[model samples]
Target: MLNVLSILIGLLSLVIVIPAQIPFLGIANWIALPFIVVGLVIGQLSSSNGGRNLCLVIFAVAVVRLMLGGGVI
Candidate 1:
Protein backbone atom coordinates (compact mmCIF):
# COMPACT_ATOMS: atom_id res chain seq x y z
CA MET A 1 0.00 0.00 0.00
CA LEU A 2 2.80 2.41 0.79
CA ASN A 3 4.21 1.91 -2.68
CA VAL A 4 1.02 3.10 -4.25
CA LEU A 5 0.82 5.87 -1.69
CA SER A 6 4.30 7.02 -2.53
CA ILE A 7 3.40 7.08 -6.17
CA LEU A 8 0.27 9.12 -5.48
CA ILE A 9 2.07 11.52 -3.16
CA GLY A 10 4.78 12.05 -5.73
CA LEU A 11 2.12 12.79 -8.28
CA LEU A 12 0.37 15.14 -5.86
CA SER A 13 3.60 17.03 -5.41
CA LEU A 14 3.58 17.62 -9.14
CA VAL A 15 -0.05 18.61 -9.02
CA ILE A 16 0.73 21.23 -6.41
CA VAL A 17 3.72 22.55 -8.31
CA ILE A 18 1.60 23.34 -11.34
CA PRO A 19 0.58 26.86 -10.26
CA ALA A 20 4.02 28.00 -9.22
CA GLN A 21 6.30 29.73 -11.74
CA ILE A 22 9.69 29.44 -10.16
CA PRO A 23 12.96 28.40 -11.78
CA PHE A 24 14.14 26.33 -8.82
CA LEU A 25 11.37 23.84 -9.38
CA GLY A 26 13.51 22.23 -12.03
CA ILE A 27 16.05 21.58 -9.33
CA ALA A 28 13.37 20.63 -6.85
CA ASN A 29 12.29 18.18 -9.49
CA TRP A 30 15.49 16.22 -9.10
CA ILE A 31 14.62 15.43 -5.50
CA ALA A 32 11.49 13.64 -6.52
CA LEU A 33 13.34 11.45 -8.97
CA PRO A 34 14.86 9.16 -6.35
CA PHE A 35 11.55 8.60 -4.69
CA ILE A 36 10.04 7.57 -7.96
CA VAL A 37 13.04 5.47 -8.81
CA VAL A 38 13.11 3.79 -5.42
CA GLY A 39 9.46 3.03 -5.60
CA LEU A 40 9.96 1.62 -9.05
CA VAL A 41 12.93 -0.40 -7.97
CA ILE A 42 11.06 -1.72 -5.00
CA GLY A 43 8.02 -2.66 -7.01
CA GLN A 44 10.08 -4.23 -9.73
CA LEU A 45 13.16 -5.60 -8.00
CA SER A 46 11.21 -7.31 -5.24
CA SER A 47 8.10 -8.50 -6.97
CA SER A 48 7.95 -11.95 -8.48
CA ASN A 49 6.62 -10.19 -11.53
CA GLY A 50 9.11 -10.21 -14.37
CA GLY A 51 11.72 -7.48 -14.34
CA ARG A 52 10.58 -6.17 -17.70
CA ASN A 53 7.00 -5.56 -16.61
CA LEU A 54 8.03 -4.16 -13.27
CA CYS A 55 10.74 -1.92 -14.69
CA LEU A 56 8.41 -0.61 -17.36
CA VAL A 57 5.62 0.13 -14.90
CA ILE A 58 8.00 1.74 -12.47
CA PHE A 59 9.64 3.90 -15.16
CA ALA A 60 6.35 4.86 -16.68
CA VAL A 61 4.81 5.79 -13.34
CA ALA A 62 7.89 7.71 -12.28
CA VAL A 63 8.01 9.65 -15.54
CA VAL A 64 4.35 10.45 -15.30
CA ARG A 65 4.86 11.56 -11.72
CA LEU A 66 7.72 13.76 -12.86
CA MET A 67 5.63 15.22 -15.65
CA LEU A 68 2.66 15.91 -13.40
CA GLY A 69 4.95 17.49 -10.85
CA GLY A 70 6.81 19.36 -13.57
CA GLY A 71 3.56 20.68 -14.98
CA VAL A 72 3.84 18.57 -18.11
CA ILE A 73 1.03 16.24 -17.07
Candidate 2:
Protein backbone atom coordinates (compact mmCIF):
# COMPACT_ATOMS: atom_id res chain seq x y z
CA MET A 1 0.00 0.00 0.00
CA LEU A 2 2.49 2.59 1.18
CA ASN A 3 5.13 1.19 -1.10
CA VAL A 4 2.83 1.56 -4.06
CA LEU A 5 2.09 5.09 -3.04
CA SER A 6 5.75 5.94 -2.73
CA ILE A 7 6.45 4.48 -6.12
CA LEU A 8 3.65 6.49 -7.62
CA ILE A 9 4.81 9.65 -5.93
CA GLY A 10 8.36 9.13 -7.02
CA LEU A 11 7.26 8.59 -10.58
CA LEU A 12 5.13 11.69 -10.55
CA SER A 13 7.40 13.80 -8.36
CA LEU A 14 8.73 15.79 -11.29
CA VAL A 15 8.83 16.09 -15.03
CA ILE A 16 12.45 17.11 -15.52
CA VAL A 17 13.64 17.26 -19.06
CA ILE A 18 16.00 14.33 -19.28
CA PRO A 19 17.62 15.43 -22.52
CA ALA A 20 18.24 18.93 -21.28
CA GLN A 21 20.45 17.92 -18.39
CA ILE A 22 23.84 16.27 -18.53
CA PRO A 23 26.56 16.96 -16.02
CA PHE A 24 29.08 14.80 -14.19
CA LEU A 25 27.63 11.93 -16.15
CA GLY A 26 24.17 12.52 -14.72
CA ILE A 27 25.29 11.91 -11.14
CA ALA A 28 22.38 13.86 -9.76
CA ASN A 29 20.06 11.09 -10.80
CA TRP A 30 21.44 8.93 -8.04
CA ILE A 31 19.48 11.10 -5.66
CA ALA A 32 16.40 9.19 -6.69
CA LEU A 33 17.86 5.97 -5.32
CA PRO A 34 16.81 7.01 -1.84
CA PHE A 35 13.19 7.14 -2.87
CA ILE A 36 13.55 3.69 -4.32
CA VAL A 37 15.05 2.49 -1.06
CA VAL A 38 12.17 3.99 0.81
CA GLY A 39 9.73 2.12 -1.32
CA LEU A 40 11.73 -1.05 -0.79
CA VAL A 41 11.71 -0.58 2.96
CA ILE A 42 8.02 0.12 3.10
CA GLY A 43 7.33 -2.95 1.05
CA GLN A 44 9.53 -5.06 3.30
CA LEU A 45 7.76 -3.82 6.41
CA SER A 46 4.40 -4.81 4.97
CA SER A 47 5.61 -8.41 4.84
CA SER A 48 4.99 -8.54 1.14
CA ASN A 49 7.90 -9.78 -0.93
CA GLY A 50 5.73 -9.10 -3.92
CA GLY A 51 5.69 -5.46 -2.99
CA ARG A 52 9.45 -5.49 -2.74
CA ASN A 53 9.71 -6.92 -6.20
CA LEU A 54 7.29 -4.35 -7.43
CA CYS A 55 9.43 -1.57 -6.05
CA LEU A 56 12.54 -3.14 -7.50
CA VAL A 57 10.86 -3.31 -10.85
CA ILE A 58 10.02 0.33 -10.58
CA PHE A 59 13.58 1.11 -9.59
CA ALA A 60 14.87 -0.80 -12.59
CA VAL A 61 12.61 1.11 -14.90
CA ALA A 62 13.77 4.42 -13.49
CA VAL A 63 17.39 3.44 -13.78
CA VAL A 64 16.85 2.37 -17.33
CA ARG A 65 15.25 5.65 -18.11
CA LEU A 66 18.20 7.53 -16.69
CA MET A 67 20.60 5.38 -18.60
CA LEU A 68 18.68 5.88 -21.79
CA GLY A 69 19.18 9.56 -21.24
CA GLY A 70 22.90 8.89 -21.30
CA GLY A 71 23.68 8.42 -17.62
CA VAL A 72 21.73 10.31 -15.00
CA ILE A 73 20.06 13.69 -14.60
Candidate 3:
Protein backbone atom coordinates (compact mmCIF):
# COMPACT_ATOMS: atom_id res chain seq x y z
CA MET A 1 0.00 0.00 0.00
CA LEU A 2 2.72 2.46 0.85
CA ASN A 3 4.61 1.50 -2.27
CA VAL A 4 1.55 2.11 -4.40
CA LEU A 5 1.06 5.48 -2.79
CA SER A 6 4.66 6.39 -3.41
CA ILE A 7 4.46 5.40 -7.06
CA LEU A 8 1.30 7.43 -7.46
CA ILE A 9 3.06 10.42 -5.96
CA GLY A 10 5.97 9.86 -8.32
CA LEU A 11 3.63 9.83 -11.28
CA LEU A 12 2.01 13.05 -10.08
CA SER A 13 5.42 14.63 -9.68
CA LEU A 14 6.36 13.39 -13.13
CA VAL A 15 3.36 15.24 -14.51
CA ILE A 16 4.67 18.45 -13.00
CA VAL A 17 8.22 17.68 -14.12
CA ILE A 18 7.24 17.06 -17.74
CA PRO A 19 5.93 20.59 -18.03
CA ALA A 20 8.89 22.01 -16.13
CA GLN A 21 11.22 20.70 -18.83
CA ILE A 22 10.19 23.62 -20.99
CA PRO A 23 12.74 26.46 -20.95
CA PHE A 24 10.90 29.05 -18.88
CA LEU A 25 8.94 26.62 -16.74
CA GLY A 26 11.69 25.12 -14.63
CA ILE A 27 10.16 26.59 -11.49
CA ALA A 28 7.60 23.84 -11.64
CA ASN A 29 10.35 21.46 -10.64
CA TRP A 30 10.82 23.43 -7.48
CA ILE A 31 7.18 22.85 -6.73
CA ALA A 32 7.43 19.18 -7.52
CA LEU A 33 10.46 18.59 -5.29
CA PRO A 34 8.42 18.37 -2.11
CA PHE A 35 6.11 15.83 -3.64
CA ILE A 36 9.08 13.79 -4.76
CA VAL A 37 10.56 13.89 -1.29
CA VAL A 38 7.30 12.75 0.22
CA GLY A 39 7.20 9.88 -2.21
CA LEU A 40 10.74 8.94 -1.33
CA VAL A 41 9.93 8.83 2.36
CA ILE A 42 6.87 6.71 1.79
CA GLY A 43 8.74 4.45 -0.59
CA GLN A 44 11.36 3.81 2.05
CA LEU A 45 8.72 2.37 4.37
CA SER A 46 7.70 -0.33 1.91
CA SER A 47 9.38 -3.73 1.51
CA SER A 48 10.02 -3.32 -2.24
CA ASN A 49 12.47 -0.80 -3.66
CA GLY A 50 10.73 -0.12 -6.95
CA GLY A 51 8.82 2.93 -5.79
CA ARG A 52 11.84 4.29 -3.99
CA ASN A 53 13.96 3.84 -7.07
CA LEU A 54 11.38 5.51 -9.24
CA CYS A 55 11.27 8.50 -6.94
CA LEU A 56 15.07 8.68 -6.91
CA VAL A 57 15.21 8.75 -10.69
CA ILE A 58 12.61 11.49 -10.81
CA PHE A 59 14.46 13.42 -8.13
CA ALA A 60 17.65 13.23 -10.17
CA VAL A 61 15.94 14.51 -13.27
CA ALA A 62 14.41 17.44 -11.38
CA VAL A 63 17.69 18.36 -9.73
CA VAL A 64 19.53 18.26 -13.03
CA ARG A 65 16.90 20.41 -14.62
CA LEU A 66 17.17 22.91 -11.77
CA MET A 67 20.93 22.96 -12.15
CA LEU A 68 20.72 23.54 -15.89
CA GLY A 69 18.35 26.42 -15.28
CA GLY A 70 20.68 27.84 -12.63
CA GLY A 71 17.95 27.30 -10.00
CA VAL A 72 15.50 29.50 -11.84
CA ILE A 73 14.60 30.19 -15.47
Return the top candidate by lDDT: 3
Per-residue lDDT of candidate 1, residues 1-73 (tens digit): 5445445544544443343325444444455556555545654544343433444454454455556656432
- Candidate number with the higher lDDT (2 or 3): 3
Full-model lDDT for every candidate: 0.48, 0.58, 0.96
Per-residue lDDT of candidate 2, residues 1-73 (tens digit):
7656654644532222232245544454466567667767877776446667766776676577678766644
Candidate 1, residue 61: lDDT = 47
Candidate 3: where are CA atoms >4 Å away?
Answer: none
Q: Model 3: how far is 58 from its true place, Å?
A: 0.5
Q: Give residue 65's error in model 2 in angstroms.
A: 1.2
Total clashing pairs for each candidate: 1, 1, 0
Which pairs clash inside model 2?
Answer: 26-72
Q: Candidate 2 has what TM-score?
A: 0.49
Candidate whose TM-score is highest: 3
lDDT of 3 at 48: 88
Clashing residue pairs in candidate 3, if any?
none
